[model samples]
Target: MSANTEGFKTFWEQLTPERVAHIGEYYTDDAYFRDPFNEVRGLPAIRKIFDHMFVQLHEPRFTILEVVHQGDTAFFVWDFTFRMKSYKPEVVQTIHGSSHVRFASDGRVSYHRDYWDAANELYAKLPVIGALMRWLAKKMA
Candidate 1:
């Protein structure tokens, strides 16, 4: 672990839809953020993604499982847990993923790219598509 790695962990743990305003504290003004669904640049544009996350999901939270830091870069694996608003049984969903982040000299991330299995983590968990995804996985395997 590096000096600021703990702080970075804290920042991630405390991040929430209502607390997204603090993104600037952890990301540069011209930071680039990307995930499986969105690839965007700048702090304001990135904030919109976080804003939309809250709008679309209920009680979304991230649990940091591990952090690997080397030089000015770090990789954090996390489990994003949330509940689907459309589900009748209100099951809690979890997606295991990792983020590769490059930190600036000031300790703010300059670039963030997320890596995850979309088919297994998202589409395969769906009600209708899940069935098809399972069949496809069997065929491919």
Candidate 2:
């Protein structure tokens, strides 16, 4: 593993719920997180974002597939899986995604960006949107 890859492993291991409250230990105060759907800033806001995410998905977990780091920046390719609470016990949907993260001097993420197909992974799981999204996914695929 590369230095950055090791750092990323350490970083992810430290991302438990309790550690989220003390986000300053891992991320700069003014860090930014960007994704296809949302952009969030600051540790406090970021904390809230994570909190909401934890509650939104059931058993949300990341499986790291690849990692590479240079200087203080580490990039991780991962797959995320979880169930939407709205689906309850009836359905278990999985979402596949990847992230690009940059760590600061203190080993906290300065920028976090995620890339994924919400339409194929998420919207396709919905009852109404699922039909249209699945149709679109089939066409695109």
lDDT of 2 at 67: 76
Candidate 2 worst ten-residue window by lDDT: 7-16
- After aligning candidate 2 to the native by TM-score, how far in Å is the CA of 54 from where it should be? 1.5
Question: Model 1: which ten-residue window has the lowest total lDDT?
Answer: 82-91
lDDT per residue (tens digit) for residues 29-128 in model 2:
9999887777989888888887787778776667777776677666777777667776754566666667778877666779988888887777766788
Best-fitting candidate, measured by lDDT?
1
Off by over 4 Å in 2: 1-7, 11-14, 137-141
